[model samples]
Target: MLLEDMLNHQTKIPTEWHTSIRKVGQKFDSAAEVRLALQYYSIAKRFEYDFYHNEQRHIRVYCRFKHTHGCPWMLFASPLRNLSIMSIKNFESTHTCGQHGENAGNLRASRKFIASQIQAVLKVRSDLRAVDIKNDMLSNFSIKINYSKAYESMVHATNTGSRVVIDADDRRFRRLFISYNAYIEGFIARCRPLLFLDGTFIKDRYRGILLSATGENPYQPPHRLIVISDADKGIRATIEEFFPDAFHSRCVLHLVENFKKNMKDFGHKTNVATTLDELLQSAAYKFTISE
Candidate 1:
């Protein structure tokens, strides 16, 4: 009857749609029925204005649909809008940084907890790494992470490890690194006038350099690991870039060790060490060293 009424109307649907209108939502229905049903729904739901032009207006429609679904697992609606808008770099620039910043924090904490859970698995079956870190691979971890209430506090609000390691090389990681740099540099700035500089050659098959600086208590010792970087122009640049006011000094023991490695003569080592000590102790050397 509904089909007869639809056919009799002057608003002619294609003849190909001879099937009943009740079955219109099914995919096996005729293409004309599908098309006519879509048209009917578009007009009745006031989606006609949205149908032609890439359905940009359906973004709001999707949001409403998501709200109606009331299932958090159904993140398809949220991701659909995001994936569509992803091509427009300008649309992403505003919110992407903030979203990734929050995600970075969440990832950091998650990765740490993940590692702990994985360690427990490793104790039982150390070969789990060969398998991917999917839910199956990490079933033990997920159980602890998801089910146990006591383990919840271990999850920090801002977990970076999960975000970066799982999604390494992601654009969001790049943005997150920027925010991390800002945070660290701000922290380093607060403890001015004391800088501890040390560099070491990387070991293993490949050799590189690692250098770091931290606030030193003239009385006791520094509390935080202020900075760590390669002993190269990069580390120098970071120092010149971030901690402009702090005093610079090498770890005396490491310097002496390096001197011993390079120089054979003990007398020459003593003279070199003395000269370095004199230069560093002098007021003229303050704020003049590169790092």
Candidate 2:
């Protein structure tokens, strides 16, 4: 399923999750904990705030519009008894401005906040794309975020003690090639004189069109080395230039697809293309020079 759709299909809240009740004298283990609760409150309530004062011992925040609108809403928390045990010293939960959905952009929908919100989805679908997360937030919650934030959000959500690593320089999913040494070694040992090259479109998140080369040795004696692939000019040129002695051939599957495409463009019936494709495939496999 698409990540955006998967996100919309919600699940029951886990036991570890809990909503915060902002009240005076309410204590938290640390200032980070208190800020997280405030973050939850701001996003859920669709409001925004600015940190007026944030220190090791204390943290204070006022409405983001406090300066322009003269809003008086503010909250303050500080270490009460233990240095790390923070307690809410003051909580004024009132907003003068119309806290609309647009406020759920910028600071309100921080990357960390985005990470926390999508962490559950990541657990189930690690291959979830950043764009899908961005779409889900906008469509469902009216939150606007950039692609970089979405990408970093996934990294932060999955990187802690996890192996899913994302390296982004300009905040884009770049090219990649995957191979296994054991498979390569096995192919070499088998001494297959034919190599099959193919590319498949990746539909999943971070799935890019990638070309792969592999060989399988048949029981028959080796002839001149042959390379087969879909008719990509780059592959064709490389094969002809590098291995001049080897014979290069187009993959049979690509030829079949091309035939179907040409028939489709000419307004041929579906069965006509299918019948022709079957005929071509049968002719290719049915007879050999020995026969």
Worst 10 residues of 1 by lDDT: 88-97
lDDT of each: 0.33, 0.72
Native-referenced Cα lDDT, model 1: 0.33
Model 1 agreement with the true structure over 1-291: per-residue lDDT tens digits:
443353234133223322222221123223333334333332222211111222322211111222344312110111123232211111110111111111122212233434543454455664543233344322422221222211222221132322121122533322111123333544455543345556667797656554444554333335433433324466567666777654334444554455554454545566676665555445333565563
Q: Which 10 successive residues of model 2 have the least lDDT summed?
A: 9-18
The regions of model 2 sitting more than 4 angstroms off are: 1-21, 160-291
In Å, residue 134's CA in model 1 sits off its true spot by: 3.3
Candidate with best lDDT: 2
Error of 2 at 269 (Å): 59
Off by over 4 Å in 1: 1-132, 135-202, 205-234, 258-291
Per-residue alpha-carbon lDDT of model 2 for 132-196, expressed as tens digits?
99987777565778776777677667653222334456766565333444565666566568889
**TM-score, prediction 1:** 0.28
